[model samples]
Target: MLLISTQNITVKLKYYFNNNGQHYFQRSIPRALQRFYGDKKIVRHKLPSIHSQMLLEMNRLAHHYDQHFKALKSGQGGTPSQIQEQAVALLASHGVLPGAANTPARVPEGMYEYPHLDYIEDYLRDKKQAGTMTKVDELAQLLLSKPMPILLSQATDVYFENHEHGTSEKFKKNTLKRWKNIYDVTGGDIALADVTREMARRYIKHRLTTVKTTTVERELKTIRAVINSVIKEKSLNLSNKFERLTIPKKGKDSVARKPFSQDEYRKLIAGCVSKADEIRVLILICCLTGVRPSEAAGLRREDVYLDDEYPHFDVVEYGGRTLKTKNSVRKVPLIPAAAKVLAQYLETHTDSVVFPRYCDGNEVLGDNVSGATNRYIASLGISKTLYSARHTVKTLLDQAGTPEYLAESIGGWGKPSISRGYGDGHSLARKYAALQKALTTVLVNESE
Candidate 1:
């Protein structure tokens, strides 16, 4: 018999021979002592010989149960019932109790459990005695409510499904694609808390080798948006890990997009006259109205109001088209060239879409239209893209001395001043006049 003394309690281990000369081990506590475990004779069979390994294993098991019982006695463990059940489980696992082989271990309830929660509880109890538990409880609740080790992938899915509502299908698709690419780079299964600024910088560095800095910045922006949305919706106290990552700005070494000069614009217009009428009109609309190619291509017949006094088209968000910004939702005044193109288009057009060749069910119309436009421009010995038309419009507006506010209004660009909020904005008549003056000046210069 060996007596092991724990916290004010003694456990007796005895070795004996069974009827068939098989050795066995048994553990017991005094029946009169009801403190640690209620009076019971804990016994087990198939004992190892009294060797160093066997004695070491027995000592480890005794120390493990002793710590558990100490926690229970000191009110550090959970409820009495929980402690009792766990103690029985611990003893059974080490074969210190009879029928230990048949006992099943307890399964935790929630999907995630943390050992730090025990330490947190102990700290709370100490703080409560010191009358400083108020602020501590707040911090404790934040930890307690937070899901342990939330994955960036999981949070991103939840954010899009529940939080990101009313977004256009095109925008959603692009955003999701960017997110998937980011997940692949950043490790989808990585804990959100584990994503450091250094990791983000490394990701940007890796991407910069193959993609533009702007593209990497956009991906990081999406990551930041997803993390922010999840934190806000779930009321998580965690900070956004991607917020502080530094993104490089476009430098002198960057290949800047070349905007069309006056002569280049005229050459493009002249060259495209023999092309498809839809393509010609699409290019004209982009130049004259400054609406994005996607916005113009996704335009429906109802969006065009050529008969109105202003003769403008609505750049509204519908179908699968998405505006770049809320300010992109404005009435774009059709210049004479654009109006002439629209009239010609409406004469033979039967489809609802203004540009049927480019649109294909939730696909980004701009990408398809721009690809074709770029190819056509390349054939003309010029390197201008379809978006060069927008830069041309801006240049024309500047030359025509169009006021900043009116020019922004005409281009459906975001307002640059807080004062813009105080008024109803430039009237359609004012916008049309500004655009006419600019387009007429450019056209006359081209003709000269």
Candidate 2:
């Protein structure tokens, strides 16, 4: 015996059935919805002796249709006639229509159902066989919500604020400039999710027409970095489209910068009108210590430790200033020529900075000095820039047979190697010894 009732409502029914010597029972809807189903008799199935599973399934279908019919009656879904037509069609599709054949009617094209339990179980099993598809779909949707231009703009600002582990005004300006170029080239409004490899290749091709391979490569790397930072910060599951791009090798389409010969360097120094001039001192420091013009210009009074037995200056990031790499943060040993020039300048220098003229409130210490120095060298019939001094220093070190490690330590060239990672690299004593040997062989007349 099976007893079913719409709880405390106008509809109630008593049914009797047997399956495997046991009785079956069911209800069309829950107690909360009994008022909605009041006096509406459920359509009954008169098949062979009903089994428990079949009765349970029939109850589920009845409840599902009852809810739809309630919605239509309340004017929420459609007019009563239309709702009745849909209800009949649904019942017919499921082989539940009155006097319908045992087989289900063919569903119309372009219509589908939320999978029932049996179909749902099969779908899940197949999904397990297709790995990561669900996750990829989710990530793709998320990435589409945010455009690439917005991500690039925000990332560029953050990078400038914290470049080289600190703020660099010069680098900020340069990066912003590059970002503008990217915007101009790529039609800035394009969505990041829509950016394709073909677009990136077109941009690179455009850049190569007006710039050297190295310059194009650098710009591409900057673009890649900006996109990567955004992806990491937002935890996006997509790969960086700009990464792994093919770039020309160094010196592929451009001539390498030349180092000044000893004769040319000597003649260039002799042309400086006054030995007391800051440019003269700066040039000498670069030639001897191989420090960048910017580093020399940014030098502070406290950076110089000339009073120690082995005089050196600290090259490190301080507030607005920044080193190029971790290996660039080192104590540069002052060779004899460099120490003499610095000593002379320190005697009369009263400001906290070694070079005050170039310190224009901004931390960029070398642009003016380098410009003047380059013009001075060019006027003296030397076709070399101020950076040629650093190249000259490396050349002299190599000529003197200084070991590669010691040369790299002095010049801050190349990445830090495993062996160099051990302790504070070669001591000042050994570095100074190499410096002495290199400077002696290619000694410049300081008195000039």
Candidate 3:
């Protein structure tokens, strides 16, 4: 029964605990505007109970109702068509296909009727009694015209059909997995129209209980892409509910991927050479050449060119791993130290892959390499991940006064504003010189 005290708003807040003891906010429309809102007057949404979040929801609703009331007052709110549209939109947004709303139970005993008509009807009835529904909204207009309804299950297939080129199988599978997760939460293979903003928010909330905020954020992003793809192909008027979401920051949300300090870099590299294991070779190559760990792990026997005047390795898409960007498919000049390490390793290894133990013919075992290297760094008392080596390379290159574009090329980072259609590219000798100078900061006595 407490009142919210934002400026110009004396909002009466009604809250109750859910089955899980979660709190939410309830609101009623101004009495005069109920008819314009399809005779609905009350609204409730699951809002966070944190004070700052509650205030944020307060501000958001204030602006929302301001626009809502203004629209109705100006004669721009519900009409017969707009009213039906709102019902269809809202029902779809809540995971109910509007076309199926009018389906009568036991229609002629076999007219291919939807079996759950009673449940849907009762759900509508409960909504009406709660004063959140208007006069019965007709869905015949949609059902008759668009007989072939789009469903969430069909969305990823449509999305990937047009967009899967140059992407890895792993990327496609992960995308499908994320969409399926969304579909499962919304009651399975539901109409695309049934996907709603409320459902998306709740999904994020639910997922945060199990995974990191960034992982949930990525899931939402992939879901959004699928929704947008469906909307484009079907020419549907569906709203994408997955955009511009707020994920409240919590501890352990994101570990800053920091570059290794010079002392740490020296110590880590020395440790790598001492072990001379597959992961250690990959780590040494990555630290010395500014390539990513995956890039090094996926390198093939043919990709490394140690006999050339300027020893370098190519980062082409290989072992079922696709290059992240077009620029990622370029070559990297190895420093003399990195070249020496690769040559020594190759003399004893006979596989077609440089990091043979970390790859199958299909793809590189990225997780295995990353976990092993990071754990190794920790064993030596360094707190950086394997990817930190890439960051360290960038830092050292800048310290060595390498040109920004050269640094970008070495790191395989793309710059959309610039074109790379010029002759060949930066010379290997030049790249070698830049990288050599950069490593000078990280130079230390090799482990005997």
Candidate 4:
């Protein structure tokens, strides 16, 4: 072992030999000795290059010299080589260099370079377009890597065509935020193809147990949709990535809930009357017309055809925004009971909206009505949702012997299997006539 330090001499070194690579110094080596016996000086004498093996040896020698000088300064009696070896062991233990105590890093057997990102990018891009998901990591990576305007263009497409207005904006923003979270978790540096099914599976697990199943499903669906859109646009040449991405089957695990019954419905409407009369009327509208709460909230006073031979209301204006579905803009014949509520509700309210404002003075958006309706349902001792009112109307129609096709039409449902054309005035009139005939015993004649 060698002990070197700097002193008056330009270059100086004091060496002591020991059987083992242990060393101690009897006196303090001056600073001049360190210059002569520096790391470069040692390398010059031992090896020409500071190769990996040489670096390890140099580190050992440096540590040993330091220890020897320290021990001698403290009056410890030991050979230079003995002290050096002790320091070498300590340095190795602390992972200063490759040694017996240090585990060698394993070289990856996989590919040296990242594979093609095009297939994955294209797949995720298509899915985002088809309404599969938003803020998808897979889709985002494609944009970031290629510097394409696909993300912005895709969002614009959805905004203009699919998601628009108030609640849709909320939905889009929320769904995109979830996609961002996935990117953050995945480090956002991986290619799409490398994003294996296992990666998606882990993401799903995190979403389901850590956050919410709804959130997971929304984000996953958005991502899948973006990939689908990319495929449709011919941006991706590979087969569906969704085919490879294994999302947990969520259908069986989701709980099915029942709608409110007639008596329960009455109780809920009554409870919400005091809390929010507007909400009460909206719920009743959903109950009578089989419209969704969002649809009912979107109703306008002008949409009510009070002068019709048989007075009814059209569901035209939606959420002070847009309609639920193209078919949802149909007219529902108002039973005398529903008409009575409408007349009474219109007496004081003068806004264009039918069920306009929430109790909190907020405009009736989908979310606003949902909370009010759910709370109203809960207050009535019914463990049902506000959406249950739509079901209740459907049940009532079924009990009244209305055919399923007519029920779907009257409810303004957009079932693709059904006729997509606007209904003839005569057909609606005939149905209402039949309904009037069926309820002749119970319904009072307004024309009389």
Candidate 5:
């Protein structure tokens, strides 16, 4: 991997090797990054048998391989800008710009350029008979047609309006935030066509430097989705900038959101009892019921049914209230642990909303609760956050071997069941039973 410098170009000879009179090009992907390549620790490409040709081709492959390795390490996706730059720089080595010629050598730019009627007929017959005419037509339109000057901002505005019409405010907000990442990178004036593959590559590259690959992946996918919708709506003849791109997967050792351990759970519960705070009530309710933080914090007096048979809480979208998703609207059976504290907490305070400190009528500010309670947990020297309570429930249920559909139903997760267009879903008794079993496995053992 040593650098051999020359007048203007430096070529690494380590990548060029000959085996049994057969010349081959090879480069190591590096020890730390070998997992990303799977079994392919060393990359090998066959080179020309001739010495002069091998050296030139090797240099090009070296740059290509080096960039690829860098991308793998940094989670940067390849983009159009880099390719074009290479074309401008290594145009002499390529003989023609990359993708300019169909063949290894230059081909006629077009059949129409030399349109003799008989020649046209023969070419048409040959292309059609070979079943390659459609590909040619697509490639021709892709390369030759001048895309209309539609701004990226304009397309995004129309996409949210038309395509994702009924999406929630949170959805719209998140989508806009992700879209703004690219808009900020390239500016609002960049056209859909102008938002080239290189722009996406550079965007992922830049984002990866700061954020995780997973976040950038979602951002890129959102951009791709918007562009796709715009293309269909406007009938624009252009490729999606985010299409056919490969963003690296998260490394195996990446940190993930984990449930609180038994020790952590005891610490949190102790903190709740000692502090006697409303945010702790929100955390405990979420832990016991598997309701989202927003759902618990957003509960109205009408939503709580302390006298009910199962003593549950309803998550209806009445008034101007909103849940994360439609499935988030359900009734969760109140666990005894949550019920004991919450029942006492809600007795004297006659505010319509349960956690008024974190909520404003129907407009529930769960994030405020999350921030305050996360600080609370951190104060106790516990590493877990308030949201970990919800994750803890899921993990507990999983350990208790709760059925997938039952778990989904209890957590108000995902789509409606495929059974006869859905009835009232799992009854309160069944949902409570499954949840109680999970909590019993974790909480009952811990508390004892």
Candidate 6:
């Protein structure tokens, strides 16, 4: 078969042939045609495409002709078949299949590439929606997968929207400051996976023995929160490290908790001078009502109900800075003596506050009444922090045959444990009133 084309003085032609059982090609046909016409432009334009197709056809024909030649030579008993067999035998001896050798080697496509972070972020987001886990748990899980900076950023975002966020601005500031401090100490650059158990153990050691245990524990809890959140939100794999991290048990003498004894209370009240009368009255009100200093400070004249079946003060105003917990909000019943003290204190002032001077009926007393109260307690040769009043209430409830659960409830202790017997509900005044009543009962019995 032959193909030819010409334009002006150029000519292009393809010649194909079969000879016996073989295919042959002659290259001189295109040169012969170009000489016959001399049109080089047409020859140049079609040369590349024509040459490529002819080469492919020639290669295919050579392959077919070689197969036929091999068969014929094999029957003729030549060395060609023997050489071919020997070649195949060598390949097979080397554990290579001759049939497969020509089938073309297949190269498996490279594996799918993936980003390491996408797995971690997805796990954290999934964990966040599951409500059962604590925020600390979620955070710990997140931190375990993500880097510290990412975890820290997430924690900061969550902290601003938490129950603690709405508390006193000081509380928020202090918490943020603590986080920054931890970040500085930890280098703030490592991934959660890189933070090994050994590092955690060392950090815990530093917190318990050198630094304040509470401070370290608080920061630890925050970090734990980050991990837990990640696991909760993203389904990230993580171990619960907080389970192994033990916070120190507070020593009895360390926390500055002292409940006033009967004699100490009497001496404290007696030591109030003319100028310190308001503080004295405040102490008395605290002792009798068993209200916290902050709760007491926020008390208003109108908040007291003298006409109810039981005269009591409604602790509606939390510390001007905080509402604290739900237990802090309740009506605290006052005994007749405490009620009388409150009435007398209110008579001296015509403002909203039951004890107006502390706030000028505007601001509430914060958690720092210790300075004034401590001075007054010291003047009487008695030494005690005003918080001792709260403990005093717990001790009094125990001594007066009040049921533990009732006492705990009155003190706002949801569940009274064997260790920390009473709750934080005004433990001072309740205990003081109970002690005074017991003393009076003892004196009456002795007189009889």
How would you encode candidate 6's per-residue C-alpha lDDT over 1-448 as one tens digit per residue?
A: 4434356444333435434424345332122222212222121111123546756765554454345334434443223233333332222222222233223333446733323223333544665676554333333343343432224434455545554443556555655666565444456644344456666666666666656666677777766665565555545566645445766563422565777877776555444322335777778667655567766766777778876556777766434345456666656666655565566666776776666656545445453465776776777777677778777777766777866655654555555453543444554355434544533421222222
lDDT of 6: 0.52
Tens digit per residue, CA lDDT, model 4, 1-448? 3333356534233333222434322223444333222212221113213235544555556666576445535533233323333333222222232132223333467643322333334544666787674332332343333332333224324433533342455455545665565554454534343445556667777677665465566677776665465555645454444444444675546665566655675565555444446767777667656677776776677778776778887766433355657777676787665677677878877776676564212234567778877786666677888776676666666677866667677776645233533456566675565444433332233343
- Taking all chains together, the TM-score of candidate 6 against the true structure is 0.49
lDDT (Cα, tens digit) per residue for candidate 3, span 324-410? 678787768987778877899898869887877787756877668888878888998987788888888989989889888777877
Greater lDDT among 3 and 6 belongs to: 3
CA shift of 340, model 4, Å: 2.1
* C-alpha TM-score for every candidate: 0.60, 0.60, 0.60, 0.52, 0.57, 0.49
TM-score of 4: 0.52
Off by over 4 Å in 2: 1-155, 158-168, 234-239, 248-251, 360-362, 415-426, 441-448
**Whole-model Cα lDDT of every candidate shown, in order:** 0.65, 0.62, 0.70, 0.53, 0.68, 0.52
Residue 305 error, candidate 5, Å: 2.1
Q: Residues 1-448, candidate 2, lDDT per residue (tens digit)?
A: 4433455744333443445554433333334333333333333333334445655655665665566555544544333333343434333222233223223334676644322222323433465677543432222223322322333445675555445632666666666666666665556644455567777777777777788888877787778777776666656666777777776564478876799987887776555424657777777777778888888888888888997778889887776776677788777888766787688877886888887887643475556887887887888788889898888888888988988887887778865455753246446767788887887745645544
Better of 2 and 6 by TM-score: 2
lDDT tens digits, residue span 208-306, model 5: 888887787778788888889888888988888788777677554257778888778866776675565677887778778878877888898888988
Candidate 3 residues lying further than 4 Å off, grouped into runs, are: 1-154, 157-168, 180-189, 204-217, 231-239, 243-255, 416-426, 446-448
Off by over 4 Å in 5: 1-150, 163-172, 184-189, 232-235, 250-254, 316-327, 348-351, 361-366, 413-426, 441-448
Error of 1 at 38 (Å): 37
Clashes of 2: 1
